[model samples]
Target: MSATLNPNIFRAYDIRGVAERDLTTESVVPIANSFAAMLVDAGSRDVALGRDVRASSPRIAEVFRQALSSAGLQVYDLGIVSTPMLYYGVSRFQRGGGVMITASHNPSPDNGLKLLINDVAISGDRIQEIYQGAQAGRKIVADGGAVHTTDILDTYVTELTEQACIGPRALKIAVDGGNGMSGPSITRLLDRLGIEHIDLYCDPDGDFPNHHPDPTQIDTLVDLQRTVLEHGCDLGLAFDGDGDRIGVVDEEGRVIHGDRLVIIYAREILKEVPGARIVGEVKCSDTLFSMIEKWGGDPIMSRVGHSFIKATLRENGALLAGEMSGHMFFKHRYYGFDDAVYAAMRLLEIASNVPEDAPFSTLLADVPDTVTTPEIRVDCPDISKFGVVDSVVSHFRALRPVEDIDGARIRFENGWGLVRASNTQPVLVLRFEATTDAELNAYQSEIMEVVTAAISACDDSV
Candidate 1:
């Protein structure tokens, strides 16, 4: 184990870095050893491991599993599974914890891990604790634990089929897996659901030769939209590299952003669980909150991270929580983990009940929408991102009404804008949602002005 390993790999929510530069075998082995040692210290004897289609994922998982086994921890290998499947394995099989080898929506040259302790996400202080444990060389290595392989795909598919109440309807759909981990499970689930669909780039090709696995980027979804339109399919769906988040296109080949999807899902959830609590991140549309309220559900706002959303969900017993990035968590009748396949199935189920003419777009047609900017990322060094956010917060506090949920969210008369530091990247995230294009432009301009001033201050302070 080298003492020169970069501790920045252990980030706030997950372990992520460029594959060769930061996530090499040398660093990963020790990090896995450290992670296994943490589990052992917490009385965990068995763990589950899964990975996406990234080229680095297999080797990484193998090394990680070996590290866990070396620490006397049993490792159940779920070869080539989605992140949610890893979570499912941990919760369903009662494993001590789970590790998913994926960079999520990152570029192909990057890969990392999302770790769970006893089926719960380990973040915030716990992440620091893990890094500290690794730094201190505090690890337990015994001879009892072993590694084994399991095929849980059938079980995963069956559970999803039960959750999906898609009544019989002859509908054509197109799904683009982006050459990621969602293909296998998605194909299996759709088969069980008796759906007739076309699969584009369904193979688990780590090279991501088709496009980047991130469906949130409109460019990545171009093929999906084309397929849907050419085939005259009812809808088009795409999943990120790990299959935890999703992006969708309606029949008219229009992208339905995640916030609108949340609005659609909330309407359905409110029917079954009236007055139930729903959560949305600061990046989500204010229309979501108002719509949720109109549908008789209480809408709560939260920070823009999975750990934060999951914690808020558990605390409030929220039926659902959604992020603008297409991460949807449903606790209405399923686990709270973000599962894109499950979400797609739920969408299909909802679509089944609507009239043939009433497409998924109809749900959002009535919701008041403003010219919202897609999430904008500005490059800022990791060390300076938080300081920039702090300065922006201070500036906004003095300028106008602001909400300090996870960042500085400035409220305007007809809209709102947010400037927050990204938890997963060296960037500042900005979003503007307004009642009109003019207001949205104004909001975006005003907030960016504050952010620009703040960035200047950050540079001066540095």
Candidate 2:
């Protein structure tokens, strides 16, 4: 416990850090102890543990298992599975809690843990409690316990494939796992759907020798995009490091954002369950909401986190929810977790019913096109980023009302701009959208002016 721990590693949704630095074996003991104590308090004696194909994942997961076992918890080890598979193992095994050793879409050196208790994703203050307990080196009574290893992969894939409600239209898709854990299961799921897949970088390489596992980065998806165009594939599928988030490209080689992806899912879900509530995160296009309403479904706007969106979905009884970052949760036909492989299956099923003449992009031909900026991240210290957002919020509120749900979303007649602090990184995440390019630029400029001043003001105070 004497390892120098970086306080910033305790993120809003998970405990993330540069693996070799902040997440050293010595540093993980207290954090694991804190989680074990929390699980014990929640009456979760059986814990399922899984890891991504990161260089440090096995070591980190082993530490977690040992610590939880020391606390008299039964640890089920799901060896080298994707994040969604870990979630599946938790539900299938009926474990009271689960831990995933991964950093999601972060860089290679980064590694972290995603946690659950009582089948609920832990976030907000609960995460802070873990951090606090770890800071205090919280000690729990250690009654001896045992660890058991099992493989939930085969059962997990079978269940997902069995859930396919697809037509007989065979598909040709290019899948890029980016050397993460999604490669093995995606192939299985697609095969079960009877779709032809051109696989790329699906191998499990912790070093990420080919490219980073982040599909959102545009660069990481270059190979997939090229393959789709060259091979005349129907679509391109990409996954992040742990397979929870997804990245999609159309037959035209255009990136289909998560917001648009959810729109497609919503349209289909509403057909099955009319008036089903669907959640669109603040980052989604405004047209998504209108279309959901147009299609005889209830639309709810949400903040931008998997846990936040999941909570919103459960609270509102929403049939579906999605983020701009490629995290989609479905309560329509499967467990309400973000499983990229499952999402691909659903997308393929939707594609099956399409006419032969139509391209994948035609799925959203009904919605009007608009201009938007990709997520723009600005450097700001974790301690000061929230202060910057508060300053921006106050500055905007003085002139016109702002939507401060997750951050400051300043609305204009034609467009809106957002300024929010990243829960996982030391930065401020900003995005803007408008009916036209000129208006989009204007909104971005206006927001950046306030943001620049706010950042300076916050930095000065700090």
Candidate 3:
């Protein structure tokens, strides 16, 4: 937080900004130092650090490592790794916490840091403390801490391979890593597991030559879908830049929604761990929650955001958790963290064991079909987004029953609508789902009217 640093880079979840404009070595030094100071203040010494495959990531990460070491914190450097690997390193190394230098699903030329403390994501006030401390030029007077280089690539691949419980069907799959951090690790894991697969953009090219490393986008997954069909692969999988969230396509080249993917996992998990807790974000489809209940598993809906989702998962001992944004976490037989690579492997395991007559999509055929919209983001300033959502909440709550857990999810007789503020960007996230197209349109239209009025009021007041 030097005088030139942009404080806006510190967001509700992680630290992020344009690489060229805001995140320079000068800015990274102070930010890293301040974060290390937090660790020192917490009586912690060892901190693991990793970076994605972005062009600017390595440079910023190097400076960050130097600053952390200079700030008297033991830095365990896991160079060029996915975000999940950084999380795993913290637990694998038994460190106080860790940091991942990534922009996640953002476009190239943007980068930032995701921090952890005590193996938990640091957000909200905890993130603010680091920014404030940096802005104030807080310092911890102590000798420089040690920096150690450790490679967990082989170990990570081996662990994932062993945990993969796929049957011996030798199913073919098409995988699109989108030239992000997932290539090497995923290829190695699949090879070891003896899964026949076709790889697309499976090299770590920061340029992202084929497509943006965002699986959630329709344009980005186009190649994955085509390749799956052309190659006669049973399914296709896509990963984001940092390799934590996932996107999937069935044999028919149809993109499976995130909520449906959760149902697939919950069905398998509930059979073993009956009455287990299953968590989903408020934006998730109601069908997902209902299916969980039908399977005898308790469903808990929480606010969206990885940090909040993980915290809720841990608190409830949930066997599985997911978001509409494609993040899936498993506490069933593995660590309770979101890893797209692992989720894909697990999906493959499930797909391979099914009978020849039943395909992967067939497993979810019983889910009540509903018309649902993908998350629609409305442009609203960061300063005013929350206020707009609050206004919407108030306007809708008096007229109908609403669940205000994270946002206002207004439940109608036949459908529901959600209005929430996006944590990372200046936008208001909205979604609508209903059993019928007419109901869906009515719900969407009514909610959008309220949202427009609320935003107008919020802007005038602000």
Candidate 4:
């Protein structure tokens, strides 16, 4: 039977869609079969699979597993594990590839698949090939494929605890999983690491009864910040829906953004692997690049997306890479998958080694302060967002000097502004960084004006 895929659902980086409308069983089964066929063609007979805490994930994963088994592939079901765990399983088992059923920071109503080939992320143009193969009914089915179930929770915890460099510091920590897939695994790992802490919303609930699973949004971390302050914990950590990304709060209950977290991680990583290459997305603060260089490491900027970051890291042999959205990849001690649980352990290890008075907040103290706007996204049609960015880029290039990295970054004497199309959402993303708040506001206003003008131009053309 041929699989039907909505062309709209085949995105640039991964497969994601609302479960009810875009990812029905009919659409998923054949895709899974085709994926298994792809693996067979690549000489891979065994594949690992995992899912998140969303209600639809279990059903969807089952259908996919059936397809894989029917196609003559061995399926290792690491049930209800994080995306990172799936990656680790694939790398550890030396299997063909892995699939993670998750919408990753999306709402509970959404579900999707993140595919890996030989432990490397499959994205960009490769996603198109997979969709095309599935639609053409070109899947292979053999007689030797089998399905097996195994729980890797204990192994995962042991790996994280062993990798962490924690010391004798009896620090109190607060962890908020937002009722996502990270709860059980993170709690287990923390306990094994001998860390004292409070766990909030650590129950696996698809309903997300506490708040949305996305920790990048300030509102989502409000409860976590409060919990840390109330408990007088040394710090706080929060994970997204699939537990692949992390957001942090300091001992003083101050929220730390991903760029700052990267700085902290980079500093610690440098101690172990000096002069290593580190990569950051275009959205990261300029200070990060400077600091990495000052620490005798090379800093490379890449497009925003975990796939892009991972591919770039592999190509450049980078030790670490991160984005402003809390996706961090580490290659020093483990495979370079973005794992928030592992990241939290690394942070704790670094904190344990620091002076008694030195805190996580101190990592950012030496960098010059810059006023910047939090990533502001404007809702627009998916088709319109990219065109709007192109139009804005053209206009900015004509009117002033701009850096066309991942987007149009207009440079001024005291500040810089950027406007880009979000790869993961139907929105236009805007950010500004400046020497002063007033300069930052001016740059933001100017960029807004340009973006507004570009939208008008597109509207007129339409």
lDDT of each: 0.87, 0.89, 0.88, 0.86
Model 3, residue 124: distance off in Å is 0.7
Per-model TM-score versus the true fold = 0.97, 0.97, 0.98, 0.96
**Tens-digit per-residue lDDT, 1-462, candidate 2:** 576668777777788889999999989988999999999999888999999877899899888988899889889999999999998888767889999999877788889999999667899899999988888888677676789998988999999888888876678999999898899999988877678999999987888889888888888889999999999998999998899889999997899999999899999998889999999888788889889999999999998888899899999988899998899898887778888988988998899888887888889898889899999999999889989999999988988769898889898889789999987778999999899999999999999998998888888888
Q: What is the C-alpha RMSD of each candidate to the true structure, in Å?
A: 1.4, 1.4, 1.2, 1.6
Model 4 C-alpha lDDT per residue in residues 1-462, reported as the tens digit of each score = 644578777787899999977888888876787788778788878899999878888889988788888788889998888888898899888879899999988888999999988898888788888888778876676787777998998888887877777876677889999888888989998888888889899998888888999999889988888888898888999998888989999988898888888899898788778999999988888888889999989999888899989989999999999989999998989899899988888888877766776765775788777788898888767768889998888878887887776888788888788888888778889988898988888888888987888777767777
Candidate no. 3 TM-score: 0.98
> Lowest-lDDT window of 10 residues in candidate 1?
1-10
What's the TM for model 4? Answer: 0.96
- Regions more than 4 Å wrong, model 2: 142-144
In candidate 4, how many Å is residue 258 off? 0.5
- Give Cα distance to truth, residue 107, candidate 1, Å: 1.6
Ranking by TM-score, best first?
3, 2, 1, 4
Error of 3 at 378 (Å): 1.2
Q: Which scores better on TM-score, 3 or 4? A: 3
Measured with C-alpha atoms, the lDDT of residue 158 in candidate 1 is: 92
Q: Please estimate how well model 2 matches the true structure, expressed as its whole-model Cα lDDT.
A: 0.89
